[model samples]
Target: MQDFSQARNQVLQQIQHACDLAHRTDVAKLLAVSKTHDADTVRAMYDVGQRSFGENYLQEACHKIDELKDLEIQWHFIGHVQRNKTKLIAAHFSWVHGVDRLIIAQRLSEQRGHELPPLNICIQVNIDAQDSKDGCAPEDVIAMVEKIQQLPHIQLRGLMVIPAPNHTQAFFDAQALFKKVALAYPTLQSWDTLSMGMSGDLLPAIQAGSTLVRIGTALFGARDYSQDR
Candidate 1:
C-alpha cells in the first residue's frame, strides 16, 4: 500500500510553513487534486482527514462520488465544465472551480437541486495569458462576475488559475492579477480564494494569498490515467 500518511504530512507541513512565512494563519486550504485516482485511493486519503478533493473528469468523479457516498467529501470540480455535463456536475459537486462562462454558471444554477446548498463557484481566469489555457481571459472576469452574481443556487467565491508551472515572473503576475480582482470584489462573499498553486509552487502561492492549493502528485504520487480510462 502507498504511504499516504507521509504524503499527507508533507503537504500539511508545507502549508503550515508557508502560512508562517507569510504571517497569515487560517487562510489557505489544501484541495487534494484527486483526478485519475480510484475511489479506494480517495477513501484512503479520507481516512487520513483529507475532506476536500478536486477532480478533472466528470464521469470518473461521479463514479467515485457514488462509491464513496457514505463519506462526507467536498468534491470540487477543477476541470473545465462542458455544457452537456452540467447536469451531473451540478448534481454531484459541492464546489465548481472552473466556471469560465456565464452560461455555465446559469446552467449549474438552473440544474442544481433546490434541496442542496448553493453551489460555490470560482471563475477560472487565464492567469498566464496562454492561448491554449481553459479559463476566461483576465480582462473578462469582472464582466463575468457581474452576471454570475445574479444567478441563483450559486455563490461567487473567487478566482482560480493554472499559471505556467515554474514560470517565476508569470507566477508573480498571476498573484498580482488575483489580488486585483479580489480587491475589486470586496462584497463577493468571503476570503476570495486565489486557487493558483500546485505541488511545484505551493509556498510562493500561499505567500501570495492562495487560500486554496490544488495538489495531486505530491499527495497521491504520479497519476495513472490509464486506470480511469
Candidate 2:
C-alpha cells in the first residue's frame, strides 16, 4: 500500500510551488483523479485532508460513491459521459468536468433533482485534440454557454481541457482558449474554474490561471487499468 497522506501532501506542496512560480496569490486546487483506485484509498486520502476527487467511468464511480457515502467528498465526473449515464451523474455528482455537448448538458440539467443544488459544470474544450477525443470545437464555446445559461438545474462554472501530450502549442492554445471563454461569459458567477491540468503539465496550466488540476499518478501512483476492463 502507498503512503497516501505523504503523496497527497507532496502534491499539495507542488501545487503551492507552482503557484509561487507563477506569482499567483490565489493558488490552484488539486483534484485527485481516483478513477481506478478503490473506495478505501479515497477514504484514507480524505482523512488526510484531500476532499475533491475525479472519476472517469460511471459504473465504477457509482460503486465507489455508494461505498463512501459517509465521507464528505466532492465527486467530479471527468469521463466521456454517454447519454444513458446522464441521470445518474446529475443525481450523484456535485461537479462535472467533461460536458462537451449541448444535448448532454440538457440531459444532465433536466435530470438533476430540484432539491439539490445546481450541478457545477465545466465545458470540455478540445485543444489540439485527437480525433478520438470528446470535446466541443473551440469556436462553439460561446454557443454552448448561451444554451447552458437558459437551463436552471446546471450552472456553467467554467471550461475543462485535455491538451495533447508534450505539445507546447497545445498547452499555450488551451491557455488562450481559457481566457477567451472566461471573457465570453461576463455574468456567470461560477465562471472561474479552468480545469486544464494533469500530472504531466500542471505547471503551465497553473501559470495560465487554471483553478483546478486533476492529478492522478502523481498523487496515487500508477493506476490499475486491468480492473477497468
Candidate 3:
C-alpha cells in the first residue's frame, strides 16, 4: 500500500502556507476527492486523519460508502446532481457540493430522511461561464439561492466553483459572488462555506477566501481512469 501520511501532511502544510500568505486566519479545510479510488484506499486515507471525502460517480461512491460504513467519514457528492439519484444521495451523503438547480434542491429536500440531520449543500457557480461546466450562471445564483434557502430539509451552505484553469480573476469573482449572496441572505446561518479550489489552483483559491478545497491528485496520487473502461 502507498504511504499517504506524507502526502496528506504536505497538502496540509501547503494550505497553512497559503493561509499565511493571504493573511487569512480561517484556514481552508481540505476535502479529499476520492473518486475512482477504491474503498481500501479511502480507509487508508481515513487512517491518516482525512475525515471528509468527495466522490463524483454515484454508484461507485455508494459502493465505497457501504464498504466503509464502519468509519465516521463525511461523504460529499461533488459531481453534478442528477434528479434520479437525489434520493440515494440525500440519504447517504453528508454534503452535496454541486447543487445548481432549484428542482434538484427541492428533490433533495423532499427525499432526505427525517432521521438524518438537514442535508448540507453548496450551490455550484460557473464563474467563468464555461459552456461545458455544470453550474448556474453567476447572475442567476441569487434567485436560485433565494428559492433553495426555503427548502426545509437542506441547509444552503455556500457556493462551489470550478473556475477556468489559471484564471485567478475567476476565483476572486467567485469570492465576490459568495459574499454578495451571503449578504443578500443574512438569515442563512449555515451560509459560510465557499467550496472552491483544487490541486492546481489551491493557493489562489485560498487567497480569494475559499473555505473548502477539493484535493485529489496531491493527496491520492494520479488516478487511473482506465479501470472504468
Candidate 4:
C-alpha cells in the first residue's frame, strides 16, 4: 500500500500553500478519487483522515460502501450519471458530482430514501464545450438550476467541471458560473461546493476558487483497469 499518511499530508500542504498564494482563507477540501482501488485501500485512506471519497463506477463504489459501512465516510459519485444507475447511486452515495440533466436530478430526488439526508449534487458543466465530455452546455445551467432547486430530496450545491488539461481559463470560468448561480439563488444556503481539479491541475483550480479538488493517482497511485474489465 502507498504511504497514505505522507501522501495525504503532502496534498494537504499543497492545498494550504495554494490557498495562501490565492489569499483564500478557506482551504479547499480533498476528495480522494478511489474508483478502481479496493475497499482496504479506502480504509487505509480513511485511517489517514480522508472522509470524502469519489468513485466513478457504481458497482465498484457500492461494493466499497458495503465493505466500509463502519467508517463515517462521505461517498461521492463522480462519474457520468446514468438513468438506470441513479437508484443505487441515490441510495448509497452522499453526493453526486456529475448531474447534468433535470431528469437525472429528478430521478435521484425521487429515488433517494426519505430517511436519509438530502443528497448533495453539483451540476456538471462542459465549460470548454469538449465534444467528448459528459456535461451540459454552460449556457443551459441557469434554467437547469431553476428547475432542479425544486426537487426536495436533492440539494443543489455548485458546479463541477473537468476541463481539458492546462485549460486554466476554464477553471476561472467555472468559478464565475458558480458565483453567478450563488448570487442568483441567494436563498440556497447549500450552494457552496465547486468540484474541479484533479491530481494534475489542482493548483490552478484552487486558485480559481475550487472548493473541492478530486485527486486520484497522486494519492492512490496509478489505477489498474484490468480488474474493471
CA lDDT of each candidate? 0.87, 0.87, 0.94, 0.94
- Model 1 score (lDDT): 0.87
Comparing 2 with 3 on lDDT, the higher-scoring candidate is 3
- TM-score of structure candidate 3: 0.98
84-191 in candidate 4: lDDT tens per residue? Answer: 999999999999999999999999999999999999999999999999999999999999999999999998999999999999999999999999988889998999
Residue 100, model 2: lDDT of: 92
Task: List per-candidate RMSD values in Å.
Answer: 1.6, 1.3, 0.9, 0.8
lDDT of 2 by residue, 40-111 (tens): 889988988999999988889999999999988999999988999999999999999889999999999999
Worst 10 residues of 4 by lDDT: 220-229
**TM-score: the better of candidates 1 and 4:** 4
Candidate 1 has which clashing residue pairs, if any?
none
Residue lDDT tens for model 1, 1-229:
8988889998999999999998996758999999988899999999999999999888888899999999999999999899999999999999999889999999999999999999999988887788788989878887897788889998888888887777666656667776776677777655377787899998888877788999999999998866644
Question: How many backbone collisions does model 3 have?
Answer: 0
Model 3 segments more than 4 A misplaced = none
> Model 3 — which ten-residue stretch has the worst lDDT?
220-229
